[model samples]
Target chain A: MNKFREGGWHILLLLICLVLLLPVVFMISNSFKTLQDSYHSMLQIIPLHPTFSNYTTLGRQIDLLRLIWNTFFMAAIVTLGKLITGLFAAYAFKYFSFKGKKWIYLIFVSTIFVPFTVIMIPNYLVISKINLLNTAPGVALPQMCDATGIMLFLKAMDKIPKSLIESLKIDGISSHMILKDIIIPILRPSIISIGAIFFINSWNEYVWPTLILKDKSSFTLPLALQNYISSEGGTNFPLAMALSTIMIIVPLFIYLIFQRYILNSISNSGLK
Target chain B: MNSSGSKNKFLTIAYLSPTAVILLVFMVIPILYTLYLSFFDWNLISPTKNFVGLENYTSIFTDSVNRKVLLNTIVYILLLLILNFIIPYFISLIVKFFINKMKNSYKIIFFIPSLFSLVVGAMLFSWIMNPISGPVAFLMRHFGVALPNWTNSSAMAIVMLCLITNWKVFGYNFVLLLTGLGSIPQNIIDATKIDSIPRWKMVRDIVLPLNKSIAFYVLILTIVQGLQYVFTPISVITQGGPYYGSSNIFYHTYLNAFVLYKTGNASALAVITFLVFLILLYLEMKFVEGRMGNCE
Candidate 1:
């Protein structure tokens, strides 16, 4: 009876897993099919006459490499910018005693409560006025005011004992030297985890990029994918899937390599 | 000593300024600017700004279509709360019950979809639900059944949007709930076992009460992020239509600003959405506090 029950539960779990994995599986398989094959063999998991024609067509239609490069560059710069700002802000909150410290910290953390929609228009106006629209810096700069990153680093910094910092201070070390020599090394794991998160978020961001970027050459991968879906590849299932598959491939690899850190940061922050 | 005291003050300001300036210019200023713009009548392209205090707010309240957009926004949030929070909470419970040594692997697999960009997931579903050459149609044909045009039908499109949102988000919530469950004290479970308390009763009395904070956190987040979550799917899949069937306030706001050049109206809507979120957040905090107080 015990073995039977366990076996049944396993089967149930497997079925649930299959349902979850179905779309991902379908996307990869269909991306390999010819357009005609995709239409005919819709339900089939594997294409009978699989071909790479869809991918080749996608390459001809858009500058795939340039789009990917734009996405990577933006994500990298935003991640680095967020880390620097987050660290300094967190250091101040963690190490210093000052007037209105709690209030200042609260103000920073409370930005999370203000949804992006509430600030979208004015942010657009600001970016446009500064003539940063349709530029990579335009897409990245507004995003660097990251409350989540600051909060995460603050929490991580709190875990490091004050005695250590005090000891370094007594040894004639300046605050900057303490940050460089003591804090950075101890917080390396958290730095990497938070950096991965910021990178993935900026990479996958659609709404801001859609609004800010206008030039075809400046389009992020998500915008490129949206453009394909809406205009270029209308009702062309194989081509759309091919473009989506390519979009997923880069982040998919990053997620695979940094799965542990990514999941850690997500579960820790509990903010999506 | 005086120099050192002054130096400390200067250093503190220096450390905090970079983040503070960015937040002020980008976040604080824009939020205030949005509120300020709500009272003005200015096209985004116009050089002159005309102050039209309360007119934009009045129009959204009076307009019939905008009213429906408001209603749809509320409905979308409530539906998302149920689908995203309630269903996932129970699913996490079930997974926790049956999970064994392979729990970590199950978690990673579930989160795979969430790792993909929202637009990518939305486009993939656009293909999967494609009426003429999609999998749903293909499967229905095999069963000698018919599937409605999922994204085109008025009644089904919003529900379909809800389901897709749930699919992308379910894993993230599941992981959160799983962590919540893991935090339950082992000794309490062992103690409950000693009493031979019925399993369901024990879970109700012990597990649920202990997990209240995380459950509440999940609920609050579902409400807060719910509006933004549906935007991508609506835009990509339905364009908020087969004649405004799935349009919510967020999509409506986007339409006003970008498509129609109604900057003042969009600003008003944005402010209204923010106000609604604040009210909801206050209510949730009160409810959670009341529940915890009762438990104590």
Candidate 2:
């Protein structure tokens, strides 16, 4: 009887998740439809006659390879940049005492609340001045240091024992070595999860990349979709859906693989 | 301030320099520059910034379209709070307590939408909800349902945008609430069960208070950061169209600077946004620091 009730609850949860994710279902199903079929089969959760033509057509219209490369490379740079910078800054905050430390730490973490528009105009000017406009590095540069990475690192760093660090210090270990040998191994799980988050965020970033990456060659995956969705509304629906389907693959992969780490990080961070 | 050894201060500064430099160049300087630019008129390409004192601020206040955008921003905030935070909170509680099996699967499944960009969500919904050709409308037609064109009306436009963000982000807040619920002590819940307390009452008296911190974090995230997620969808779907019916303060600022080349007005709006967020964030940081404990 109890098992039956549990099964019923599972059905209920499945129904709710389906309704919530209906758009995603629609997107995936429609990506396999033909252009004419896309218009007609709007109600169907599955394509009547699925085809790969939309992808072939989309690939011909845009440089799909370059765009994917741009997005993947940019996300990688952003992930690594954020991890290194955040790890260093968080290390300083955790291990050292310095003037204006509290205020500085607060300021670093408070960048979470800094509205994006407030900085874009000046960042644009600076990017243009530095000749990084229309470059992958330009898109990656302004985004390299969000507050979540810093905060995540700080939270993870809090767990390492002070006595462990003090013993290392007494053994005449360099700060870099202490961080490398002791702190980092313990933090591997957190670093992977946080890095996944940073990567996924960078992959899906649109607004900042839209500002920096003007050339189609430098366009990220999200920016590439905007081209099909021109200023005037002559949208190529099936092709657009096909491209979106492709764009979703990496993030879904990361989520599936690192879900445990990500969930734990989120819950652990939230609890405190 | 010094650590156990005085010499390590240099190492502290060394460790801190990269973040300091990045934040200064990217966050601090841009904010100050925006404030300075807000005082003067510049076309972004012009050789000289024409100093115009408080003219930019005055125009943003006096302009009718701008006022509508401000009103739209407030509507978006309230609607977003409903769709993104409150709805997700309740749903999370339901999933946690009512669903006894595969709760983690539900979380993982729900979060799938959040993995996709809002650009995709906008496109998908715009097609799915297309009044003439959309599935929703096509189904509605059989029932003799007359659907209002949401993009045509400011109120519905804001609501629709908020819903898109909700779809993209609902799982995130839901999972957060679930996490909060999970953190409630088993003993407390077991005690409630022993007393035969009603489920709703248990949720109200025991569960809600226990999850206050996570709920607060979710609230701040939805408020301070939520609408920016709506930006891509706005640009993609409506472009704040039907006479700027759906434009928020941030989107309006973008149009002003990027489209109209009115750098001064955009800068002024940016400054105002910065000040507003700064105050809210100040309080949040104080709360967080209180919990995290004061200086190391």
Candidate 3:
């Protein structure tokens, strides 16, 4: 009886996994199909008449390469900014005994609870006032101060032995030198893990970029894809799928490469 | 010694300034500004602003459609809390039980959906759930069953929105719960085994208690992040359509601000939403604090 139950359990698990993966499979398979093939043969997992027309058309219609570059550039800058600022703040909180340190930490962490919707309109106003709208830096700057990243770095920094820092200080090492030589090496994995998260998140960001970026040439892949979808209005299914495929490829690649680090960081930190 | 102490303080300020400044300028000030903007009637482009004292708030309460939007927002959040956090939680346990050897592979596979941009996921699902020529319709035809236009029908739109959002988010929560499960000390598991405690009882008595903190964290995240999660699907797929059927307060606010350019109304909605979530956050923190104190 136990054996039978175990067998049933395995089958159920497999079925669940399949259900989770089916949409992804559907997406990739259909991206290669012709427009008629996609519409007419919706149930087919593998395209009967596969073609590259969807992709070629996508490239011609929109600046696919530029969209890709814009996304990569924005994500990189945001990740870099978050890492630097997060490290500095985490270092201060972890290493120093300053007045109002606890209060400052609380304030920073509380920003996590403030949903972006609350600040959306005002932030837009600020951006537009400064004339940073439609620019890459504008899209990246507001989101760079990541509370979760600071908290993650702070936790990681807390684990570093205080004695080691003291010894480095005795050697007349500056705090910056100590951080460069000691703490960073120890926290490299966590940093990379957190960086992957920052990259993926900023790359996948839609609403903020949509709000900030007005020019078509400046549009990130997500906003561009959303625009294409709304503009096309389901008239061209295959091309939309193709564009969706292109938009996801880089992030999917990043995720696959850093899957271990990403999972490790998420498990270690309490971040979702 | 005093000089070194002052220098240390200077360094601390220098190191902390970037984060502090950004938070103050972008986060803190914006929230304050949003509150201030809630009372005004402004189109965001016009040079003139009119003060409409308490009118936006009054309409939010009195306007029937706005009331329904609020109700829909609450319903969406409740559905997400149950489907996104609660269900995946139990599923995570079962998955943990089954996938002992291939855990990493299974995790990656499940998380694939989450890796896709929400816009991309929304677009992809818009096709899959397309009523006329999409796979869902085709499959329904094959099975001799009718699959309603998932995104268009008022009745099914919100439920379908919930399901799609759950699809994108379930793996992340599952992994989180799995981490919670993994933290269950082996010694306790061994003790439970030696006692021959029934499996379900072991889970209840030993596992559930220890996992309470992480579970609470997930629950809180679900509630706090619920609006952002539903925004994508509502925008890309449903457009909160079939006569505002699937529109939550967040999307409603977005439409008011960006699409309709009613900046004042949108800001008012945002302020109200913030207050509501603030209360939710307080309750969650209080609950978790009490539970954690007991656990320790």
Candidate 4:
């Protein structure tokens, strides 16, 4: 009876996972299929005959490597920039006991609630006005700072006992030395956690890039993907799936590798 | 103390300048510029501008198309509230208390869809749910069931798009709620064991009360983020199509400015959107627990 109860829940949970993961499985599975095969063979979870021809189609239509590189470059630059800037800001936020600190923090945090729609037109105009449209830096620049990282690092810094920083302060240590020697090492895990989130976010960002990047060469993976679809619609499903699989693979791998950190980052958000 | 205080102030500005500059340049200025643009008519390409004054705002109400788009926006909010908020809230509870083995596996699996770009999601679902050649349609036919072309009908089209957003967001929302549930102290549950309160009752009484702050936070996030998430699917799959049936506020604003070159109208709509969410943010600030939205 006890084994039955245990087995029952396991089966149910696995069954649920299978259902939820079907789109992903369907994607990876169908990507291996031929165009004609994709249309007819709905039942085949695995392709009856797999081939790389569909994958090759992606190569012919677009600069697949360049697309991947563009997205990767943007994500990397934005994530690194966010970390450095957020670190300094969060550190300043914690160190200061100014008269207007409360109002200042509120202004920083209020950026989160400014819906992207409100700023889309003006940002686009600003970028184009400055002749930054169709550039990777243009796409990455606006996303380089976020309050989430500032808040995460600030909270983590708060948990660092004040006495530790104070004891060092009596030695008249420069803020630079204290930050380099103490804060960076203590906040390493949190930096990784927040970094994973920022990286994945920039990787998947679609809308801003759509407005900013105009050249085919500058297009990120997601933008290139839609470009492929609009031009080659209904001509090939397997090819489309292959492109999607390619676009998804990196983020999926990152999430799997850093699953703990990503999950921990999110969980930490709601708790505090 | 005076010199040190001035030194501290200088360093504070130095440390804060990187973030402050980006936000001011990208965020603050944009809001103000959008507000300024809302009052004038400009094609964006041409140098000429026409002062429309309040015509854009007035037409948003008087115009039938804008009214329908607003209605569609309301529908999007309602459907998204169900898909991303209300439903995930309940599911998180079940996952937390029941069938708890391999919990991490469940979390990982659920969060996978969220990891993919919304563009990829749009492509995958459009392929999978294609009425003619999609696998789902093909599978349904074998069972003597005919699949409806939900994409053609504006109402069903919106529902389909919402479901697309649900796939990507539900897991993210679930993880947030489950993490919130985990924050409830262990002793409360242990104390309840003496009374042998039914699981549902324990959840209703003890769990729900303690989870209020995080729940409110998730609720506000679903309304705000959920609208943005649905935008990609609408543009990719529907293009707010079948005669603007599926277009919401965000998509409509995009369409007006970029697609139709109606910058003033788009700017006006954008201002309205900012105000609407600003009120929601105000409510969240006033009511939600200070800490839940902190460290966000």
- Candidates 2 and 3 compared: the better one by DockQ is 2
Q: Candidate 2 lDDT (Cα, whole model)?
A: 0.83
What residue runs in model 4 are displaced by over 4 Å at the alpha carbon? A1-15, A230-235, B292-296
RMSD of each: 3.2, 2.4, 2.5, 2.1
Which docking class does model 2 fall in? medium
Q: List the residue pairs that clash in candidate 1.
A: none
Give the Cα error of residue B52 in candidate 4, in Å: 2.0
Per-residue lDDT over B108-214 for candidate 3, one digit per residue giving the tens place of the 0 to 100 score: 77777777788777776677777766677788888898777665666688887887778888888888888888877889888977998877788788788978878
TM-score of candidate 1 chain B vs. the reference: 0.91
**DockQ, Cα level, model 4:** 0.63
Name the regions of candidate 1 deviating beyond 4 angstroms: A1-9, A231-234, B281-296
Docking class of 3: medium
- Point out the higher-scoring one by TM-score: 2 or 3: 3
Instruction: lDDT for model 1, please.
Output: 0.81
Q: After superposition, how far is residue A61 of candidate 1 from its true place, in Å?
A: 1.0
Interface RMSD of 2: 2.2
Error of 2 at A159 (Å): 3.5
Off by over 4 Å in 3: A231-233, B97-99, B289-296
lDDT per residue for candidate 3 within A56-95, as digits (tens), equals 8888888888998999999999999999999988888887
Docking class of 1: medium
